[model samples]
Target: DMNDIPPVFTTVPRPITLDDDVPIGTTVINLVAQDSDGTSPNNQ
Candidate 1:
């Protein structure tokens, strides 16, 4: 049996404009990913 499963992203990421003087710790985007295999931790 194989324990390896690929991850999937249900939500699509949006594009945003950023300033050239943006801070170092600034967050551009937050992507949401999911796993089809419910048995794997990636789904959590």
Candidate 2:
């Protein structure tokens, strides 16, 4: 019944090195997150 806990990021993106030639709108890194409340949607 204690589902008031807030969502937290389980894993975050680390420092990344990109080339100067990198194009725009390119994904640099991906972030991962999760929620403990089973009743609430996994909307991290």
TM-score of each: 0.54, 0.50
What is the model-wide C-alpha lDDT for candidate 1? 0.71
lDDT of each residue in 1-44, candidate 2, tens digit only: 35566777778757899999999999888877776766635333
User: What lDDT tens digits, residue by residue, belong to model 1 across residues 1-44?
Assistant: 24456666777877799999999999888888765665645455
Which candidate's lDDT is highest?
Answer: 2
Report how far residue 10 has shifted in candidate 1, in Å: 2.2
Query: Which ten contiguous residues of candidate 1 have the minimum total lDDT?
Result: 35-44
Show the lowest summed lDDT stretch of 10 residues, model 2: 35-44
